[model samples]
Target chain A: MATTTVSPPAPGAAVPGRRRRTPLARREARWAWLFLAPWIVGFLAFQAGPMIASAWLSLTEYDVINPPEYTGLDNYRELMADPQVARSLGNTVYYTALHVPLVMLISLGLALLLKRVGRLQGFFRTVFYLPVMTPAVAVGILFLLLLNTQDGLINRGLALVGIDGPSWTTDPDWVMPGIVLMSLWSLGSTVIIYLAALQNVPRDLYEAASIDGAGAWARFRHVTLPMISGALFFTLVVNTIASLQMFTEVYTMYFGNRQTQTSFNSDAATFYVIHLFQEAFQFLHMGYASAMAWLLFLIIMGITLVQVKLSKRFVYYEGEDQ
Target chain B: MLFVAALVGAAVIFMLPFVWLISASLRPREYVFAPGFLPVPFAPENYAEAWRAVPLVTWLLNSLVVGVAAAAAVTLSSAWVAFGFAYFRFPGRNLLFGLVLATMMLPFAVTMIPTYLIWSELRLTDTQVPLWAGNLFGSAFYIFLLRQFLLSLPREYFEAARMDGASYPQLFWKLAFPLIRPALLVAFVFEFKASWTDLLKPLIYLRDEHLYTLPRGLKVVLDRFGYGGEQQWEVVLAGSVISTVPMIILFFLAQRHFIEGIATGGRKG
Candidate 1:
């Protein structure tokens, strides 16, 4: 690891006259601002600008065609009472809660399995991550057929085992679960991430634990889990954020076609972002939708804060003792 | 022995859905759901038929153009900014860089409605501009990626070049860009994938029939071909195959770079 100690401005790495004096320091600062002009400008316009506007827009009633009227927290107040907002947020929370655990387990398991394989590791790793590389829309459409209750391969496989497969996309109760399954199908990238983290875990730690009469589960618990907690935290945070705003799969499977908007199971797959999308774009309820976005934003921020606090308690960084 | 068997078995089962997808695409429309999971009575005509269902060729070309443009924008601009973050120190530099990292956690949905309004106000909505314009600005993830890669390079090279009177811009272009090509490629590929797979942005912004990307066109195909449950499912699957195969090919072509990016992203800050 290169010592990231700021290193005293790199000793005039980009220009001569190596000193930390005012004029030289000002020159470096000017150069940095010049070099970073594009990102800084774009960040202001695209990122910070949208954030501010979204906040203000949340307080007003505006359709695209008409000017915004000050609604004075009506949007947020309505959000408190709206059943759909509750449903969408509930669905999203259920998904994030379920998907994060499933992804962590599956990716960690696959990473562990891959670590043991020798010659065929590359082949198996490629196969596992292939779905992750595939577009989500394509994956969703394919799963729609694969999880079809009647002729789908999943149902067929279940039938051969003497079990009946429930409706995946149709059953309201099973809809989000089915989407969760679809989302987890592309666990390859997360698996690869875990695999990298696993590689960094010192082999001697495992050996030491084994020699100390720790069984396989005990070694994994004490040595492996502690070592990989940082990676686990990383994946958890990322997956939580993505799952909170999951739209592609849900939109692709249930509401891909506008003709199906009036279908029975429309609300079944109504995720937070998808609801926000329909409200903002389809109905042009930009202010209401902006309010929903902010509400979802607050929920995500809260969850992330809680996770960080909890991770601080449990995550064992290898070098923190130093 | 048990572990090996389980791993291989798991791989096969994990791949079953995709294998089934390809088989379903190749099977004759009538036999697409015929219990057997093989591409029997193969009909490649489904691809041709799906192609004709919409202006798929145009959409494909549009997707390619948008993807390449967005990838270039994301790569170059991100590398430029990362050079600044990696090499220089200024007042509030840490704070500004922190802001860049902070943006990564923001859901695009939070900014989507307002950005759309901004674009609409500029009369740029209902076009493909909304899909790729923001990407021209460096994204936080790619900026962080390139910055990490840049910091990993020995600083002495820039110092040597500076002794020869190379300007910061020249150092960035001539030295830093070439040195960090792999990370740049990673950002390029990521942006390309983002633009390629994007649905919501295109769905909201691209209302014209001819402006659809492959993903959006696949939806159009679904509407036209897979309207009722009884309609042809093979064609939709065929469209999906078309949408997916390029990414698979790209993955195979640059597997090392792609894997390295994923691994490095996990390892670094």
Candidate 2:
């Protein structure tokens, strides 16, 4: 890595030797702004603006047809008071806790398997990733069909093995397990990341480990893990954020019926975003949803900050290793 | 030999959906109950009947329009932003780039409802605009991906363009675009795949039967067929197979980039 010297700016001094903005530079800036205008407008109009609105809305008692009444902390207070909200939050954390680690593990395992397979590397990779290309709606439907109570293939297969299968979707206990299973099948994206990390690991480290008579597990622990810790951190952070915001599977499979508005059964799967959707769209509590959104933002930020802070303990950077 | 068997086993398991979809599609309506590997007395009309049952062709076209529009929009916008970040030094450039990265953390959940409201207020809902426009800002992920690729290119090429009085647009369009075709194609395939298989936004926004995408269209078929209990079992499976086949073909066609993007690289933040 290269480092540059840092210069201190003079205190309370207007620097006379600042780089002048040239005509070409100005022209480029204008073009840059023009090129970036859509994104700027979109961020302002959709993301940032709504987030601001949602924050404000979270404090008010607002329905769709009526103007929001200022009811400071009422929504938050209600959120604290609501058992269903608590259940939804608990369910979300449970789902994330169960899903993210499982996903990371399987994806890494699959990637390692592919790494071991030398000849048909490209072919096997493509086969595993085919599911990633399939849409969530299709995935949900496919799983729904697979998990059907009586005639579903999964149940039938279980029967063939002389074991009866539980009702997968309808039963609350099995429903989450079914969701976890579906998630495991779609670990293609993470597997790709692991493969990339694996490729980046220097061959010399493994060679050195072998020379030292280290077993495969020991080599992996000391060599592979450290080398790819950067990628692992990146993947872990991203997977955390994405898993926390999961919605499409439940929305497609459970709540596609528009009639059952704000019910907790589907909302039982309300991993954070679904709750925000429910508040903002279903109940027209835009302000409350906004607060929830901000809370979500803060929670994610806090968690990520803590992760980055604590990353030094486990994350082995090459420069640091030297 | 063991390795080959393991790979084969995994492939077969992964390929189960495609096999089940096709087999179920070909079975006679009454033969749905039969306990057999093959669909007894194959009903070829299942395909035709599924086609008639829903606006399958129209839905496919709608999906194409949305997919192409989104793919193009994301590709162009990402390239532009990526070029700026990769090549230029300006005030707040690093901060702006950091801001873009930070946006990646902002959950779609936070934005989904407000986006719908804004579109509804603008009366852009139910049109293809919402579908394509959802991607118009260019994704943080793609921008980052493109920027990574762009950084690896020789800087002197752009400097040479500048020395020759090549305008930014000219440099971007003529120089950058062609050189980064591989990265651009990767982004295109990604955006295309996401939009093509997307069901939620379309389901929420598009109510018109003619405007539905394939996933949404397939749902209509499933609902009409209404799970395994009803008689239209073969037709349901046939429609699913029909919906899945194009993607299967596209997967085979772009298998190189798709595999590269998913199996080994392009996903790290």
- Point to the candidate with the largest TM-score: 1
Taking the tens digit of each residue's C-alpha lDDT, what string does model 2 give over B1-269?
Answer: 77677768877877776566567678788775455557667888888887887788998898899899999999898888788777665578778878887787886656766677778889988787998886777778788777877777777777777778888889889998999898888889878888888776776688788989888887776656744225476766776676667777788888767766553243343
Docking class of 1: medium
Which lDDT values do the candidates have, in the order given?
A: 0.85, 0.74
Docking class of 2: acceptable
Which residue pairs clash in candidate 2?
A: A54-A290, A57-A287, A57-A288, A58-A287, A58-A288
RMSD of 1: 2.4
Per-prediction TM-score to the true structure, in the order listed: 0.96, 0.90
What's chain A's TM-score in each predicted model? 0.93, 0.85
- List model 1 lDDT by residue over B74-187, tens digit each: 888889898988888666878888888899878788888878878988999878877777877788889888988898888888888987988889999999999999889888
Residue A128 miss distance in model 1 (angstroms): 0.9
